[model samples]
Target: MTKQQLFDDIEADEDWLTGLSTDIWENPEVALQEHDAAEALGDALREEGFSVEFGVAGIDTAFVARYGDEGPVVGTMGEFDALPGMSQAATAEPEPIEEGGPGHGCGHNLFGVGSLAGAIAVKRAIERGDVEGSVVYLGTPAEEVGAGKVYMIQDGAFDGLDAVVSWHPGWTNAPNKGSCLAVDTFSVRFEGESAHAAAAPEAGRSALDGVQLLGNGIEFMREHVADPVRIHYVVTDGGQAANVVPAEASMEVMVRAPDRAAVEAVSDRVRDAAEGAALMSGTEVDVTKTSGMYGVLPNHTLGDTILANMEAADFPLSEEQEAFAADLKETLGSPSYADVPADRRDEAAEAAMFTEPLDAPDEGTTGSYSTDSGDVSWTVPLGRFRAATWPAGTPAHSWQAVAAGKDLGTAGMLFAGKVVAGSLYDLLTENELLEEATAEFEERKGDREYESPLPADADPYELTDR
Candidate 1:
C-alpha cells in the first residue's frame, strides 16, 4: 500500500477512533489505577489481531501490543492516565462533569487512541506487503503522576526496538527537537525526641527544626545553582501539634535540571544539606529516592522524518472545527509565546488552533517539564512531536484543556495518527533513515548506560495514591 493509502485507512477508521477516545474521556482514571482504560485498549488491540500483553513491568495498568514479526520493529507510546480533581464538561466555561472528580485534563484520552490508530495502520501496511516490519504499541499508564514507562524500561519491555515514535497533545504543532529537564523526585524524613514545648523543652530534639533548617538550606542553595535548576518541596508531615515537639517530620522534594548529571549533582548537595540539618538539630535523617527521568536525547534525523510526514500529510481542519477551537480560545486568557520563535510569536499568538508545523528549536533549547518518555529515548532512537489538541493559549491540566479535548482534541489526534503512520512507513521501508537515526542515538547517548533511579525493592504501587 502507498503512504496515501495508509492515511486513507486512518481516515476511514475515524468513527471507531472517536468512539474509543470519547469513552476514555468520559471515564477518567488516575495514575496506576487505570484498570478500565488498559482493558479497553487491550481489547481493541486484540480485535485488530495484535497480540496483547497486560501488566507489563509489574504495573497492573501497563501493557504491550504487537503485530507482525521477523523484521524491523518500530514502537509508539500511548499514555492514558488522567489528572486528579480536574473534571470538566465540553463547554467554554468551567463546568465539571462531577465536582472534584478525576479528568482527562492532559488529553491522554486522545493520546492512547491516536497512537493506536497509527500502529494499526502500520500493521495494515505490513500485511499489504508494502513494509516488512513489526508494529508495536506500548500502552503506557500513569504518566500524569507515576512514571510507569520508567519501570517498564527497567523490566526490559522496550528491548530489541529499531526506533520509537511519540506524540503529545499541546497548543502548537511542531516536530520537537527540544529537550526538557531531567528530574529527581525524593522524600526526606527526620526523627528526634518529643517533649512538651512549655515544659522540659531543652530535653527535646525537634524534628520540625531539622525540616526548617533543610528548607532554609534549599533556599540558600537557589543562588548557587544555575537558572534552569529548580528545587521545590512540601512538608507532608510537620508535627502533631504546636504544643508538642514533633517526634517526626517529612518533606517530599523534587530537583530538576537540564540533564541527568546536573540533577544528580544538585540532588547530592540537597542530601548533604539534609544530613547537616539533622546533625544540627540532633535528629536522625533518612532519604529515599522515589523516581527520576533522563532528559530526552533529541535525534534531529528522526525529527526530520516526523517533520517530513507532518508537512506531507496536509490535512487542515474544517470550518466547524475551527469555530469550535475559536470558541474555546475565547474562554481562556491569551496564550504565551515565550517558547515560540521571536519572528513567529505574532503568528502563534493570533491562531485559534495552530495547524501549521513550526521549525525545530535550536540546540540547548530545554523545556521546563519532564516526561517518562525521556527515559525511553536513552534506550532507543526516539522521535517526539506535538499536535494542537487544545486552543492556542490553553495550558495543560486545566478546565479549558478538558473542554477542548472532546472534539477539537480529536481532530489533532487524527492528524497525529496520520503523521505516525507515515513516519513509521518511512522507517520501515527506508533502511538508511533508521540507520541514521540509530547512529545519532548512539552518538548522543555516548558511553552512559541507562540506570533506574528507584531503589531495588521500590514498588510502583506506592505511587497510585500520589
Candidate 2:
C-alpha cells in the first residue's frame, strides 16, 4: 500500500486509539508505578497480533512488543508516567480532579497511545505483505523521575534496532534537530553527632550545617562554570526539631550541561564541593550517583523525512477545538516566546494551535530540558519531533497543560501518529533514506562509544521513591 494508505489505516483505528488515550488520562500514575497503563497497552498490542514481552530489563512496568520476523527493525518508545502534584481537570481554569495527586501535565497520556498508533499501523502494513520489516513498540516507564530508558539500555534491551522514531507533546509542530542537556543526579547525606542546642552545643557537629554549606558552594560554583551549566538542589531532610543540632541530613542535587563530557566535568566539581562541605561542618558525607542520561544525538536525515510527511499530511481542527484552544490561550496572558528567534516571535504568538510545521534548527543547539530518550538517541539512529498538543504558550509540567490534555492533546496525538507511521513506511520501502541516516549516525559518532553513566547497583524504585 502507498504511504497515504498506511496513514489511512492508522486513522481507521482512531476510535480505539483515542479511547486508550482517554483511559490513560483519567488514571494518571507517577514514575515506575504505571501498572494500569502497562497492562492496557500490553493487552492492546496482543490483540493487534504483536508478541508482547513484559518486565523488560527487570523493571516491572517496562515492556516491548514486536511484529514481523525478518528484514530491517525499526522501533519507537512510549512513556506512560505522569508528573506528581499536577492533578488538574479538563478545563480552562485550575481545578484538580484529585487534589495534590498525579496528572498528565507533560501530555504523556497521549504520548504512549500516539506512538502505539504508529506501531500498530505499521504492523498492519507488514501483516498485509505491503512491507517486509519489523515494528517494535517499547513501553517505557518513569520518564518524569526515574529515567526508565537508561536502565533498559543498560540491560541491552534496545539492541538490534536499525533506527528509532518518536515524538513529544509540545506547543509547536517542529522536528527537533537540536540537542538536549545531559544531566547527572546525586543524593548527598551527612552524618554527625546530635546534641541539645542550649545544654551542650559544642558536642554536636551539625549535619544541617553541611547541607547549607553544600548549597552555598554550589551557588558560588555556578558563576565560575560555563553559561550552559545548571546546578540545582532541594533539602529533603534537615532535622527533627529546631532545638537539637541535626545528626543526619540529606539533599538531592542535579547537574546538567550541553553534553556528556561537560556534565562529567561539572559533576566532579560538585562532588568535591560535597566533600568540602563535610570537612567544614565536621560531618561525614555520603554521595551517591542516582542516574545520568546522555544528550540527544540528532539525525538530520530522519528528521527531514518526518518533516516531509508532516508537510504532506493535513491537520484540520474543528470549530469547537479551536474555541477551546482560544480559551486556554486567554488564561495564559502574553505567553513568553524568548526561546524562539526574534524574527519569529510575533508569528509564533499569533496561533493558538500551530498547524504548519517548522524546519529543524541548526545542529549543535541544545534545549533546556532532559529526558531518558536522549540515551536511546545515542544508542540508535533516532529521530524526534514535537506536535502542538497544548495551547500556544502553555508550559509543560503546569496545570494548563494538564487541562488541555484530554481533547486538544488527542488531536496532536493523531497528527503525530500519522507522521510517524508515514515516516516508518518510507524507511521500510526506500532503502536510501535509512542508509543516509546510518551514514550520518556513523559520522557524528566518530571515535566515540556509548556508555551508561548509571551505576550497576542503582535501583529505579529505590532512587525515585526516596
Candidate 3:
C-alpha cells in the first residue's frame, strides 16, 4: 500500500483511535502502574495479528509487540504514563477530570496511542506482503519519572532493533536531530535534634539550616560548572513549623548537564556540598541518588529520513480544530503565543498544516526537555519528531496541553502516527536506509557502550526518596 492509502486507513479508524486516546487520557495511569493501558494496547496489537509479549523488562507495564520474521527489525517506542496532579477534563475551559489526580499533562496518552496506531498500520502493510521486515512496538512505561526505558535497556528489551522511530506531541512539527541534556535526580536528607525554640534554642541543631546551607553552596558551585549544566532543587521537607527546631529535613535536587560525565562530576560536587552543610550545621546528612538519564545521541541519517517523510506527509486540520487551537492561542498571552514560530502560527485566520521548520525550537520542544529517551538514543539509532498537536506555545504539563490533547492534540497524534508508519515502511522496504541509520548509530556510539544511568538493581518505581 502507498503512504497515502496507509494514511487513509488510519483516518478511517480515527474514531477508534480517538476513543483509545480518550480512554487512556481519562484513566491517567502513572509509570509502572500502567497495566490497564498496556493491556489495552497489547490487545489491540494482538487483534491486528502481531505476536505480543507482556512484561518483557521485569516491569509489568512494559511490553513488546512484534510482526513479521526477517532482517531489519524496526521499533516504534510508546509511552503511556501521565504526570501527577494534572488531571484536567476535556473541556474548553480548565476543569479537572479528577481533583488532584494524574493527567496526560505531557500528552503521553496521545504518545502511546499514536505509536500503537502506527505499529498496527505497519502490521497491516506487512500482512499485505508489501513490507518484508519485522516491526516491533515497544510499550515503554515510567517515562514521566525517567526510568522506564532505562530498565528496558537493562533487561535487553531494545536488542536486535535496526532502528527505532518515535514522536512526541508538541506545538510545532519538526524532526529533532540534536542532543538533550543528561539528568540526575537525587535528594539530601538532614538529621538534627528537635528542641523548644525559646527554652533550648542553643541545645537544638537545625536540619533546616543544613538544607539552606547546601542550597547556597550549590548556587555558588553553579557558576563554576559547565555552561550547560543546570542545578535545581526544591525543599521536599523543611521542618513542619517554624517554632520548633526540626529533627528532619530533605531537599530534592535535579542536576542536568549536556553529557553524562559532566552530570556525574557536578552531582559529585553537589553531594560534597550537602556533606559540607551537614558538617557545618553539626547535623547528619544522607545523599541518595534517585534516577538519572544520558544525553541524547543524534542520528542524522534517521533524522533526515524522518524529516523528509514529515515534510511529505499530509497533515490537514479541520475547521473546528483550527478554531480550538485559535482559542487556546488566545488563552495564552500575546507575548507567549508570539514566541511560537511564525510559520507554525495560524495565518489568514485559519489553522494551516505547518509546512516549514520553526526558526527556533518551540516552547514545548521535545528535545528541549530532558527525558530517558536521551538514554534510548545511546542504545540504538533513534529518531524523534514532533507533530503540531496543541496550539502554538501551549506549555507542556499544563491544563492547556491537557485540553488540546482531547481533540486537536489527538489529530496531531494521528498525523504523527502516519509519519511513524511511513518512516517504518521506508525502513522495512529500503535496506540502504537501514544501513545508513545503522552506520550513523555506529559512528555516534564509537568506543562507547550503552550504560544505563540507573543502577543494575534499581527499581524504577522506588522514588519515595526522589
Candidate 4:
C-alpha cells in the first residue's frame, strides 16, 4: 500500500484511539501503577488479533503485543503512566478534576493510545500482505519516575527487535537526532537519636541536621560540577513538630549529566556529600540507588527516515482544533520555552500543528531532562519524534498540558500516529533503511554496551505499592 494509504489506516482507527486516550486522561494513574491503562491498551491489541504477553519483564503493568509471522521485528513503544499531584480538569481555566491527585501532565494519556494506533495500522498492513515483517507494541510503564524500560531490558523483553520507533508529546513538531542527559535516582535516609526539644536538646542527635547539611553540601557541589549537570532533591521526612528532635529523616535525590560516565562522577560526589553530612551530624545515612537511564544515542538515519514520513504525512489542524488551541492559549497567557527566540514567544503562544524545519543533527546538544526511553535507544537502534500536542509555549508536566491532551492534543496524537505508522511502513518495506540505521547505530554506539544501573535485587515497585 502507498504511504498515504498506511497513514489513512491510522486515521481509520482515530475514534477508537480517541476513546482510549480519553479514558486514560480521565482516570490517570501514577507511574508503575497504570493497571487500567495497561489493561485497556492490552485488550485493544488482543482484539486486533495481536498475540499478547502480560506482565512482561516481571513488571505487573508492562506488556508486549505482537503481530505478523516473521521478518525483521520492528517495535513501537507506548507509555501510559501519569505524574503524581498534577491533577487538572480539561478546561481553559486552571483547575483540577480532583485536586492533588494524579493526572497526565506529560500528555502520556495520548502517548500510549497514539503509539498503539501506529502499531495497529502497521499490523493491518502486515495482515493485508502489503507490508512484510512483524510489528511489536511494547507497553512501557513508569517513565515519569522509575525507568521501567531498564527493568524490561534486564528481563530480556526487547531481545530480537530489529529496530524501534516511538513518539513524545511536545509543543512543536521538530524532529531531529537530539540527545538527552543520563540520569540517576537515589534515596537517602538518616537515622539519629530522638529527644524532647525543651527537656534535653543536647541529649538528642538531630537527623534533620543531617538533612540540612546534606542539602548544603549538595548546593556547594553543584557549583563545582560541570555545566548542565543537574541535581535535585526533596526532603521526604523531617521533624514532625518544633518541640521534637527527629530521629529519622529521608531525602530522594536525582542527578543528571550529559553522559553516563559524567552522571556516575557527579553522583559519586553527591554520595560523598551525604556521607560527610552524616559524619558531621552524628547520624548514619543509608543510600539506595533506585534507577538510572543512559543518555540518548541518536541515530541519524532513523531520524531522517521518520522526518521524511512526518513531512509526507502532514496532518494540519482543522479550524475548530485551532480554535480550541487558541482558547487554551488565551488561558495560557505568556508562553515559555527553554530555548525559544525572544522574538518567537508571541508567535508560539497560539496553538497550531505544523512541522518545524528539520534541524541539523548535533551530537553535542542534549536535552535538559532525562527519560527511561533513553535506555531503549541504547539497547536498540531507536528513533523518536515529538508531535505538537499542546499550545505553543505549553510545557510538559503542567495543567495546560493535561487540558490540551483531551481535544487539541488528540489531533496531534492522530498525526503522530500517522507519522509513526508511515515511518514503520517505510522501515518494513525498505530493507536498506534498517541496514543504514543499524550501521549508524553501530558507528554511534562504538564500544559502549548497555548496562542496567539497578542493583541485582532491585524491585520495580520498591517506591510504590505493586
Top candidate on TM-score is: 2
List the pairs of residues colliding in candidate 2: none
Predict model 4's lDDT versus the native. Answer: 0.84
| lDDT string, candidate 1, 141-223, tens digits | 98876467899998888998899999999887778897988998877899999999999899899999999999999999999
Candidate lDDT (C-alpha), each: 0.88, 0.88, 0.82, 0.84
* Stronger candidate by TM-score (2 vs 3): 2
lDDT of 4 by residue, 186-276 (tens): 8898999999999999988889999999999999888898898999999999979989999999888999988899999999988998899
Candidate 2: C-alpha RMSD after superposition: 1.4
In model 1, what are the clashing residue pairs, if there are any? none
Can you write out model 3's per-residue Cα lDDT over 108-187, one digit (the tens) per residue? 98999999888888888888888787899999998887767888889988889888999888777777776777899987
Cα displacement (Å) at residue 302, model 1:
1.0
lDDT of 1 at 199: 91
TM-score of each: 0.95, 0.97, 0.92, 0.95
lDDT of 2 by residue, 432-466 (tens): 99999989998988888998888776777765745
> Which stretches in model 2 have alpha-carbon errors above 4 Å?
338-343, 362-364
Which residue pairs show backbone clashes in model 4? none
- For residue 247, model 2's alpha carbon misses the true position, in angstroms, by 1.3
- TM-score, predicted candidate 1 vs. hidden true structure: 0.95
The Cα error of candidate 2 at residue 351, in Å, is 1.9
